[model samples]
Target: MKIYKKGSLYLTEGGEMRDDLINIYKDAPAIFETIREEIGKVVVGQKAVVEQILVGILAGGHILLESNPGLGKTLLVKTIASTTGLHFSRIQCTPDLMPADITGTTLIEEVEGSKHFRFEEGPIFANIVLADEINRASPRTQSAMLEAMQEKQVTVGKNTYRLEEPFFVLATQNPIEMEGTFPLPEAQLDRFLLKVFIDYPSPEEEYQIMERYTGHAEPKVERVITRRELLSLQQLVRDVPISDDLKRAAIKAVVSSRSWEGVEYGASPRASIGLILASKARALLSGRDYVDRADLEVMARPIFRHRIILTFDSERRGVTTDQVISEIMKAI
Candidate 1:
């Protein structure tokens, strides 16, 4: 249950949390509420999805968003980037996209009659990169993003370039569009901390969406938090305490997935790690000083859904990954 990062967390001589750290934890809800209020300016609903995205941000993890087309997935990511004041970039993935197109390429340049190679950074260099319709990209192009997403760095040649801090890849994919699309490899999918499913909005929410977009003046959202503040929040999220019992619960859910009847392949150790981290972030978002069972219950599906593979019988019976995860949690 012990977690360590490069920077130290503040604690007193008795090993209790410092007053300043406690203050930050107490203020977390208000700060996140302001962020949601800004995002609500444009997005009409999907509060749960928004919270999960915030969890990914606070956990310093990448996210994969899946939904049918025209569900505002791209708009949501854009709004989050805008609200957080993070440098944003978008890559419209397509079959023709090359590996160099994503990770950048070395280009020859001449200066003062001397020619040399210079690395040109790609769209992946931003703080928050939106890989729109990621499944549409060629496998080669998708693979190019693995290093940047996992290692937070890119290698063009013998030299490697470090991406800016707080880097995240918020990728989107259409669930129904299978034609002419390359499915992401298991390795690539494993890299995503959470796979969020965006459902259709309610009629009331849709009506409000129409009202907002049909108007002559579009709704405007202002940045609520800066990069430095967000970085600090990320650090604080890691320091949020989780009891051994809850940590064991998170691990048990992951382990149960391996022997779960419907699951063919279980989640990796990364899932256990991601589940714990996501729960800590969720607790902080709820303005709690410690992780709760509710946090683990709520985050289980997103953490394990993409990591496990369903059995043929389960697929034929129309059982989904979420259902399997739910059973695992209940058993644990």
Candidate 2:
């Protein structure tokens, strides 16, 4: 692990960070570990899922979680929010859900003696938000989040309100093939930094989960980091260094996807950006300041899965996005 203290993290002029900032980077592991440990108490399994959530949050990006029901996806998100001590909110996406429902609206209210319209903040104002079953919502309703998710601000009426730092939207959706689900458009999917998939737990882990929940109450989660520390940690994660070699490799991985056989479309430049940022976050979590090949390889799938659109022939041949991504990974 490389520990940076009161020195430039990069050779660039903007790398001249303060001493306290240096201290935060050095102490990041402890903070991350403590949060992980706290999350472990309530979450029975899905270690990888938990790590992905932390990576997305630390990277200062949004995450789209995909999994079947009863996989502890919601539990994992709640546990992460509790341990990190961030304000949490949730919206159950449905066909009737409107854009204002998530972004809030101005309504007439009595103040003292007079009644006037005031803007009330919505659930999107929180540091961590869970959009459960997001695919159930109509596309128009879903489009309401475009501004807040990308620009970190919402334009309601003539006013634009900025979201607080460390704001993250953790949305979940079932398989698109399922009924009553509106497939997220490519444009909307592109906004998410990564798409994380959760699988079923092992028999042993399942038994433990049953024993813990059915037999005993899960332990209370303790806050490991405050909002201020979280903001500093996100900054430190962005500061992690990457050599030019790895930077090109990340770009190559994305560009190759566009023309790869058995695929119709490829990831955009944003995918490249997500790969670098996510890889850096993974490295920071591992207590290393320098990103390695393994970091990029591990993050490849999540970075590319949702961004790529498979062709009809590829679909007929039973070629999945992960399968295509694996080929790209091998090629890279």
Candidate 3:
């Protein structure tokens, strides 16, 4: 692997693209469109949100989804899992939820008149795990997810269990200001590759939603791409090329956040890496062979929003993290 560095950003070149990768790259756009269409069968709108989720998936990273209630955040994850043919499991987080509830507990079993310990896997063992209302879970419970999100494995007592291939933790949370919510720490939040914000649908889309859900017939979607194909595309996404100039711009955008006017703290080096990877994914999704300025601009906010912290003055003035990130982008 060839590496390029500027500041903390390091770009690893996917050496020698094979014929299979070329075919996959050529087919990626149509497949991605089919995926969006399948998801649209169940979900009404939020095209940008869906695309960002797909970017996270292609990059093989975890996602943190935020929105008000009834925005179909949970439905989005389920639809993605179904359409992609990945094993799906959901964890409804609550205050009383324990660590063992998310990562399996060890149980004692008797076999051949002998007692032995057996580890019964928890919901985290699935290909795609949905942690709904993650903020409702206690801090201790939230910590249990860190290893799985970052390392894609669970350690129970003395044993370690490896998660299956193409694993992802799609966690949804209500806004921090909402009641009964515990704010996630910076370290934990950094583990997420993208922080997607799902907005309310338009009046026309809401009408369509009511029409679909109110009737006797329920909306369903067929599988768009198989697991093996998706896994292949994930590898191909990394092979998408990025120009050195755009790479430096991305690094500058993230590094500038440290001293940005409203920011009390800036994003870490991981943000730089995520921005590049997500840009490559976005380019591949659009059927482009290389990353462009548009991809970097579009991906900057979601990659940096959750990583930065604003000063109290900025918060009092009702300024958001997105605003700060946009400022940094413009300056760069």
Candidate 4:
């Protein structure tokens, strides 16, 4: 592996020694490993899920987690914030949720015998935001998040409020419920960099979970990285070098998702860009300076699963989006 001063990594032919990208690669994994260890203190099992979430963070993108209730979706976000030492805020989406309920509102307040309007920042202003059960909110309320998710700024009234740096939104939705939930529009779904599906833990992991939580025992979690360190890491991730070949491969994988058979709509250009950035982060997490085909291939499913829409034929035949994605991966 070659570590470059510009934060670009390259793999050597022998895979024994890095030429110029070794320094950049060395600093990336320590931050990730420390975060993993800290989160492990509180969260049990689902290690892959946690790592993928970290990848999303490193990629500087939002994540949408789909799972049933009580799978620790909310806890996972909270634990991530705690472990990474970032400010955390949560917004519970409901039928009556309003735009201002998330992005903040202007209020008139008396100051020195004079009334003036001031902007009060909402939960979305924090470094890490957990939009719990986001699908339950109405379309109007949900659309309010569009600008913030895409532009990293919330427009209220005539003024726009720029969100803090290193910002991330980890939204969760209940997969089992449909009656009271409003499905996220396709445009809104495209904003997420990755859609992670949280599943049940294994038998042994479940046993460990039970034993750990029995009799009012609490899991100990420590903060591993500070806010400054996290911001620096995010900047470093952006500086990581990606070759044109790997970049084109990422684009090809995302393109394949849309044009595949039995697909109504494929991923958008934004999805392609997201895949490239996410693959870089994933490679960095594995202590590799350069991104390989394996990184892009492994990340294709999560990066494009939610972005693609299935056709009626595929849906009627019990074909899942993930299954179609697997086929696309094989074809690619």
lDDT of 4 by residue, 3-96 (tens): 3233454534433333423443456677678778888876888887997898899889999999988888998899899887788999999999
TM-score of 4: 0.91
lDDT string for model 3 (164-221, tens) is 9899999999874567778889999999999999988999999999999999998899
Predictions: Cα RMSD each:
3.4, 2.2, 4.9, 4.2
Q: Candidate 1 — which residues are off by over 4 angstroms? A: 1-26
TM-score of each: 0.94, 0.95, 0.94, 0.91
Q: Could you tell me which 10 consecutive residues in candidate 4 have the lowest summed lDDT?
A: 12-21
Please give the range of 10 consecutive residues that has the lowest summed lDDT in model 2.
Answer: 4-13
Report clashes for each candidate as comma-separated counts.
Answer: 0, 0, 0, 12
Residue 68's lDDT within candidate 3 is: 87
* Model 1 worst lDDT run, 10 consecutive residues: 1-10
lDDT of 2 by residue, 1-332 (tens): 34433444523223556566667776888988888788889887788888888899989999999987878778888888998888999999999999999999999999999999899998889889999999999999899988999999999999999998889999998764578889899999999998999998999998988888886555789888889888877777777789899999999999999999988899999999999999999999999968999999989998899999999999998889999898898887
User: For residue 249, what is the lDDT in candidate 3?
Assistant: 96
lDDT (10s digit) by residue, model 1, range 91-183:
999999988888888899999999999888889989999999999999888989999998999998899999999999999999896999999
**Alpha-carbon deviation at 159 in model 3, angstroms:** 0.4
